[model samples]
Target: MTSHKRKTGRRRAVIGGLSALGITGAAVVTATLLAPAGAASAVAAWPQAKGSKPVPASIEFSGTYDGKLQRHYGTGALGSDGQDESQKPLFVLKDGAVLKNVVIGAPAADGVHCLGSCTLQNVWWENVGEDAATFKGTSASSVYAVHGGGAKSASDKVFQFNGAGKLVVNKFQVSDFGKLVRSCGNCKKQYPRTIVINDVDITAPGTSIVGVNANYGDTASLRNVRVHGDPKKKIKPCVRFTGNNTGKEPKEIGTGPDGTTCRYSAGDLSYD
Candidate 1:
């Protein structure tokens, strides 16, 4: 069969079954907001979405371990917050994976976060939901791990030395209150180390969802995309570019959508 045929086929992969070296739900997870299902943070007992791309059929992983492992979960959650919706994300990275209609019902921190390394050629996130994909990470020593509360897709930045991976977001969409994707963490100035986004829609009016964040002064690109709100109710700007709201304007990235586009390209966008 051809590559396209395989991609359009079913998904089958090997997930988690054993624990990490010293990482635990109570130890690693200090406190956080939310995250959609199938989040990388929940890799231990990573729950497969009812309608996500199957592992063996379409997925792979690269971390401290070798192959995928399936773990047992309770309430399907992450972070220190007990308000995580049950929207587990089915993370995978294989040669060919086909994702059909799927609905992740819950708040999430991130859908996928590849560390060791991964490369996916034919894949999809068609109809992916972000009930409440939050993008706020707390500091733990100096490593700056990932946060909870909010859905997360493949980051927009990556490196072979740090995290070299290929993720394609095709026919994706969010439904709840959260962000589409972001490159953040407990790092200096919160940089987008490894991640990316492609072809997506955020026609959700329940809450706003951010697409990508080019932290660390990196240039995150958003090619063919569109975001809008309900006709009856007035919503804020589709994009919120924040900065050191010093009442100053962003002198970078197209002058920024006023101060809203937190460009921070120039300096502090504080509100002093």
Candidate 2:
């Protein structure tokens, strides 16, 4: 826990300079700051919570809400962490909302639901329920940004994109998960989606990093991705799919960078 606090303090020191530039700017710049001088071989450690809180119902809010790094889990009606698709989220964010410094513990329910453009900063998930978070904003201009967080134990996806516009994930980490970010494969109201993943650390026992629907014109741009403990390189950086709106499972067409749907070069990825 002391080590976690020290790492967080270092990150916060960098954030103090970048926060004024807003979410996107902070995301872009923080990517470079993650690997500081003399610490290139260091792996990010998972955070330890200050305490725990059980949420009986969803907490919906706008503007900004900081959890102070306390572990928040589900209870009562939201206690189950099963793979049920209808589970409710622990937190709901309105448009332009910002949620930060939150640690979601086990039985996390649906984790979080963003109703519109939102920023999730330093929000870690110890055990992902339905997902770590779901982006549901239905506007071409809406941007869902996730920065400085980590998730583990996700049976399936860590982030589900069921909305439109662009979703940016930066300076994040994930381990023992399924897909990191999956654009909706069977949403009835499908729209062209954009995903930007930068400076993310992915640990093995995981699946693809970004899965996009090529048929829906979804595009994923990956940069500075670091994969650990996968010597065989089984973890794919990007996967393309032929998606649909018929409520059926989407078919995966291909994987890797194509310079079209999946964007990135070999120089953008590193194996650690």
Give the number of the best model, judged by lDDT: 2
Error of 2 at 136 (Å): 0.2
Model 1 TM: 0.35
Clashing pairs for predicted structure model 2, backbone only: none
lDDT of 2 by residue, 99-217 (tens): 99999998999999999999999999999998999999999999999988899999999999999998988778999999999999999999999998866789999989999999989
Global lDDT of each model?
A: 0.27, 0.88
Off by over 4 Å in 1: 1-112, 118-168, 185-196, 206-215, 232-272
Give the CA lDDT, 0 to 100, for residue 135 in model 1.
Answer: 24
- lDDT (10s digit) by residue, model 1, range 177-238: 33444333222334333232223344434332232232233323232333434554222222
Task: List candidate 2 segments past 4 Å from native.
Answer: 1-41
Q: Native-vs-model 1 lDDT?
A: 0.27
